[model samples]
Target: MSAENEVRQFIVAADDDGIRLDRWFKRHLEDVSFNIVSRWARTGQLRVDGARATPGDRLVQGQTIRVPPAEPVKPDTVKVKPDRPPLSDDQIAFMREMVIHQDASAIVLNKPPGLATQGGTKTHEHIDGLLDALQFDLEGRPKLVHRLDKDTSGALLIARTSRAAAFFSKSFSGRTAKKIYWALVMGVPEIEDGIIDLPLAKQPGTGGEKMHVDEKEGAPSRTRYRVIEAAGNKTAWVELQPFTGRTHQLRVHMAAIGHPIVGDGKYGLQEAFLTGGISRKMHLHARRIRIDHPDGGKLDATAELPSHFAESMKTLGFDLSLGDWIPLDDGPVPPTREQKKAMGRAHAKSVRKERRGERGRRRG
Candidate 1:
């Protein structure tokens, strides 16, 4: 084979360490489409230290990656993404207004209701399209690490760099990131402070847009809720925390327990709506997010409520000062593998010592 067609190998560098295998290709091998990478991985042509590797696998510094020869691209057959239109001056201002917190590695936006996190069929105006306005002087556009439903407004995080994106993505997927939400439900839950441990799956015939509880064939889902205050037996103000990242998890769990979130007609049907000057918009709000930062320490951000949600809180006689007082966790960090191994050894030694002492007493 010619030199150009020969297989190639690349070593991970310090800067590229901890990034996903696919992200490495995007940074170094720009011509390699993700589909091509997936094909190579599936066919065992891609390897990390002689072991086949997938695109989502994390890369360590000094690891060697085996790559197959580049395939020729036909310009006529290649499909290209259409360029997005430039943001208008008003659009730029609107995005800027949503910025609640910004740092070197992340940007937190207070996404308002009626704005989609990402664009889909017939979805033109969305937070993803407006991301360019938040780029600032960065070398690359901000990347979304997680998403909130279009109508479920609250704090949304944007990663500033590829490294931050990988780190934040792992943090979210591993359930290490904690998010707090404030919502108004139709009625108070019978169990004031409870955990909704229900499996969820997409409702059939909904085109994967809606979710429901499924006992046999569904992914495990859990949500913790605490009622902050209740307005008689009619309405309730509650705090929600999701332990698993399932589609519409909080919404489905709340509705399954018979206290559908107020204004969530999709799940609650007719009972979700509230009268007496209450807005028909979804009352769910992402209040805060706490995750370990890529650059050490933690990135904790809080978003203020939109006008409608704030007004609803006032109407329900809920005090704003008491909303954020609850701490999500006061537990210790989980032990690492090495720490667990050492603990195991210590435990065995203790057991051995206790048995030996009993034997000595019996012999005496």
Candidate 2:
């Protein structure tokens, strides 16, 4: 078939299910750009099972995607290079030692605190750059499925293949993947176990990176926390289970409740520091993760606390003998597409109502 006339059809595999249409195109058709994809989607040139599709549409298994023909790639076109640099021998050895669990589909790493998951400006070394080392005679390098804060340590999931990556990514977005974190907070919560149902929005003027409680115009966020042990009301060992995966959700939520995680200078400020002999590292750790495997069965892994975290726990007389918490079934399920749309409409209506009420109060 001529390159200009070569229309293609693809069947969505189970691995690709729940991914956005634009992402699917980028993965399978690397030469395609977001602009081209968006243009096609807007002009009805892209169809899923004979129906026009949008870039934001989530694909499901066994659906047929009809891709319109496109111009042939020119041999002289500039190619995008891999963002990561080659790994050194020492870096390779370091990554290998961090592996806590490995299988054909995924690898779980006990990522240490201060090691960024992906490289950024001024970040010369990171797990993403060295993932090639974890290939270990495999067909392809592992891919990171999700991210933990640079200061947070523990179970970071790496998918061993494109198939595994898609599956795990969907699992996380669907909220089937459960994560439990352990944190040592500066103060204890008044309630031993309760939910923090606060809305969170990015604080402006901070490069939109820092989060703060903003109920009127914030995303709905919820977290379930339990105080496991307390050290004379000065510090407490807490387990945090976040139902929503908003950036800095756990840190901001804990701080909003007046029990900031120890050593969280950004959120906790002066209260983050402890005068006792405790290490000044962020006390939060990604203690455990449980998710359904792409190839059947379950994927469960737990990471041991980093040295500083363990030492602080011991010093505070918190029991390290308490094993990891089992995946909680009571956590909120992620809203489906219809549910999310309904929620968005409701939120818009509420915002309009609040604006009217504020105008009335101002006039009064």
Candidate 3:
């Protein structure tokens, strides 16, 4: 083996206790796999103190372990040709800065708008799909923790191991994680603080791929909004706290209030669409996120306003450069749990019904 491929072994210590053997190795081995670990146990590729060990076995307070090098697999590196589409050095720096936080547990990123969180047939270098392409220690590949919309740029989280991934996966699916968004709306509301209780369903298009919002039979969505800036009848800066994390909850709710974001082609004003609306960019920005950190303390991360959003603010006459909002007033408190459950449930029902009607019309 070359010096690079030479295996490094270590003794399991007190710090490694409580975590599974597979997980411990995920932080140590290059290209670690749960399936491979399982096979190793059956075939004796792995040994604890020079003996076979099970996948679920946890290391004791002080345990001797033998981590033999993983059997050879496929080519380890992504062979990007020297002539692959040349990227500016600045662009590469931007990519690295996206990964905001990382530990043995997870990796966080500041995802830019207009980029898919993952890759598809039309997708190129999206976040999740490109995790392996990212620079990493000689340990394991990165994984995605959650998804942000294509046009919604902000704090995106990823996992480096399955154990770390499970925590976030459950947090998002169970509505424990909170995501905050900022949007420039067309007008201010009468109520300074209120909840947008709406249900959101995916409206399928002719191609049966792309997604739109429908009210028929959709998922429950709840958004709590507070006005941060009021720019007369032309526009307003608002912070949206999504309670349920439904698809396009903030956008749909703002549209429902007759204040679609400036550049939202989907739920935006038709005039804006005709006249290069919202400056040809979506106004929604994922601004902040709060989650319980696995190690300790709360994970409160924020993504600054991108240039497009700043330009939109200036174009809308919000005055000054980015983040120069003069607070006209502070809105109300966050939605209560009772409010979220009730409103979210109702919204989901309504969306589902609207989607069903839309489907019927398409069929007819």
Candidate 4:
């Protein structure tokens, strides 16, 4: 430990009362690794309420925890490097062109479809790797506060500073941030406007890439949707507002309700692709986001539909003018913290039940 570093004490917040000790460390002291936490616990260096604590030990509200000083990691010991090479001139220019809004606190990009927000296996090009191009002459590199799917095009927010990033992150995780999406589904829903309250879980055996509707073992997911226009029940332009963020929540929810977004092969199946000269790109777009800004006023931005989505709308005879209209009222109020906790508990119970069932099946 460096001379500047000292032992730190923390009081468990009400919101984190029942969370595991290791999870608490990950949330508050993100730089501390699980290995370090484990080592400390084994060596009696970590304590809660003046006693040794375990990684899985649940913390209580107002409990006192003593955290030891973290040793500064030497530069030579760092192993991981930037995943991809620096952006080329053309890549830089392309990124610059995507900027729809930029200010001291944030930058909003009209992210195009077919572009991944961050890189993964087999993914070379992504917004994260190309963000250097957006720097211009700014002092600090911009950071992504949220993410959209690879095929989802639209308003992607990038925080300009670390403070701004932390602020936006809190806003999002606290459910104060509001996002609206525009998607063209293959079939028109029977109801013009309604809410989908479906629980979502990773599909078994998918290696965590795909989501499925699993009421028994899934997290609470809700989406409010209104149909803007429909072409004789064949296809509809729908506006979606997700109340709870989940992996592929909108896509899986729509598909679970029997109206998958067009061109979504992973969730929707073959019928999702429209024939007859319509572009076979996913039609989901993150249309708008409204949130409290770090600098006092509201931060809001809207992204125009990608060219393919626009063409599809025109072909389906849906009016494009409706996209400009913002909802008169703040959409749905986010759930209370207690309600969120209850939902989380239900999901965890379901997961445990599922694991037991799987074990029984294996034994049989």
Candidate 5:
């Protein structure tokens, strides 16, 4: 986080779940201090649904809040600079180019891991704030149709106008958007492929700064995953397609099944995030996407996994790529013939055991 005074943005999480306004911002905002948050609200720096709100106001879900910056004491005299350049021209240029496809209606961006899709007061240099650097015609201010976790790189759609935003929002709300993620979980699935249908309600942490799984009252979430490449000794290259998008749903769900994506801070093995294990980045990527285009058709987008991810893939014994799509007839390159054969053998044994048990019951 540099000392730049960049314009910030934030998303209001609804209060229906009983989250407090001040508390929420304190947790969500980066570079934002608690005292500053309080003063901003007192001075009407906070707005709810475009209206001012009190610090104690209970959050209503689905409301958007905006917190304006504080007036500088020595407005013109003080400029905060960072110790080091936050993002280089080459990096910014790289980011702009990652935007694979954009139209007057929508933008398909390959978001890098470690960058927030949107922004908050504490958030500096996020994808939302960098849109101006892009060489596209965003008819007006573009809004993120969805988000990827800071450490997860992948394709995300941005609506360029309010109308387009509304269109994308509706599509997401209706569960028509198809999102695919690639996770380098540190274990193989019990089955070759399966769907995890579990409800996820966010469980608050002791410090109220982290999240966990609470199945008793969790929201409905589902994920379909297949082992694309087995990296041996409890690790695999898995392709995940989430049906219901819950925050950290994919990561948590994978962990629940005895597999967690390597380098996932909250829901993963600590060894994977340590200095020696993985350099500095997480091993989760939003690989490809298929969504309804605002203009009439489908938009397919892909993002090559970042350098850190590619390196991990090599170390983990997975030389896969998000290259051109793999066709059905395409032979065993990733989940090669030997691996498929082994899985088939395992499945056949399970089926044979089940049939024998059924016969024994009939004989009895």
Candidate 6:
């Protein structure tokens, strides 16, 4: 065996106590790729406190992690890439202009439409790339805690530190964060206020880019929408609150009820367009976001509408003052696991009672 063939051991620190084993590797062993870590776990070479552990296993403080010897690098295995080009003055100015709110731990941007939150294939100019300019006074670049669609505009939050990122991520996952969205739908709903309680699954053949209502096999999704104003039954301005963070939940829920957001051709088809010079861009905007601050208190921010959206509202003659103050409801809350189990038992009991009643009626 080579000199480097000896195993290495690490003790989990308090800061990394609850982090996954793979994440610990990334933080400390930057040269150790994820694939190597997975292979070590699969071959029983990776362990925590003398027990075979997976990459996803959470580490506890003072736990010993046994790691196999570093794999030797092969010829042409490592690729050296150039560093990112420095941001131009214009780019830095634009990114700074997007900031609507900033605190020690968080920064909120009034992200405009057409700029993606993160880059994908063929997408080069994105908010993620511009985050470097927002890193003012911070050693690390701010991290995105949530996302908004490329066509949707409005309040997007960024965490200035890793601790803030973890805190904001937990707040969103716990559903304690409140997000209010505004959208102009194709038609006015008969009910001014209602909840869309449909289950959603990715539409087959769309490559998971589109969502549709699925009854038998789908994740539970719920959205509460209230019509703020209507223009002669042709269109309505609505406020949307999603209880579950499904992909495109607000867009899918609105479309499923036959009132797709204006200009959403993917889901609404030709009917998504309006003829009265309304902007062809998607009309959904995240109007406001409120969440618990990492330090204390609450961080609440409101983003102004994009120019196109503001113009459309002016054309519709809907007062801007009326838009932001709509009373929010308690909204749809997901059932807890214990509540679901109790409901299941109650449903089975009802079924048994009905069966017994059927037998009694036959005897009569």
Candidate 2 residue-wise lDDT, 39-131, digit = tens = 988999899989999999989989999998975678888597777667789988999999999998999999999999988879977888889
lDDT of 3 by residue, 271-327 (tens): 333133356678788777777766667676777778888777766666433342333
lDDT of each: 0.91, 0.88, 0.70, 0.87, 0.70, 0.90
Instruction: Estimate the TM-score for candidate 2.
Output: 0.82
Candidate 6 per-residue lDDT over residues 140-216, each given as its tens digit: 88899999999999999999976677678889998889999999999899999887888899999998888999887
Candidate 2 deviation (Cα RMSD): 7.4
- Against the true structure, candidate 6 has what lDDT? 0.90
Clashing residue pairs, backbone N/CA/C < 3 A, model 6: none
Poorly placed runs, candidate 6 (over 4 Å): 1-18, 38-54, 59-69, 79-82, 327-364
Tens digits of lDDT, candidate 1, 1-364: 7977999999998657799899899889988999999999999999999999999998998999999999999889676769989999999999999998898889999999999999999998999998999889887889999999999999999988777887899899888999999999998888898878888999999999999998888887878899999999999999998888999999999999999999999999999988999999999999999999988999899999989999998998888888888998535434433467899999999999999999999999
Ranking of predictions according to TM-score:
1, 6, 2, 4, 3, 5
Off by over 4 Å in 4: 1-84, 326-364
Model 5 over residues 1-364: C-alpha lDDT tens digits? 4324544556653212245676666556544556777787778767887787876786665777776753345556544655533556876687678778877677788777888877765887688767655535543556677888777887888877655665677778877776678777776777967777766765764453344666677676777888888866557888887777788889888887878788876777673453435555678888877777757998777778888888877776676753234322112223423456899999999999999999999999
State each candidate's clash count.
0, 0, 17, 0, 12, 0
* lDDT score for residue 326 of model 5: 38
Model 5, residue 166: C-alpha shift (Å)? 1.2
**Candidate 2 vs candidate 3: which has greater TM-score?**
2
Candidate 5 local accuracy as lDDT? Answer: 0.70
Q: Cα RMSD to native, each candidate?
A: 5.7, 7.4, 11.7, 10.6, 13.7, 4.2
**lDDT preference between candidates 1 and 3, better one:** 1
**What are the per-residue Cα lDDT tens digits for candidate 4 across 1-364?**
5544888899987646566899888778877889999999999989999999999998887999988887687787666745657678899899989999888888999999999999999998899989888777677778899999999999999988666776788788888898999998988899988878888899999999999988788888888889888888678888999888999999999999999999998999997888877898999999988889878998889898899988988887778887657482375565644577999999999999999999999999
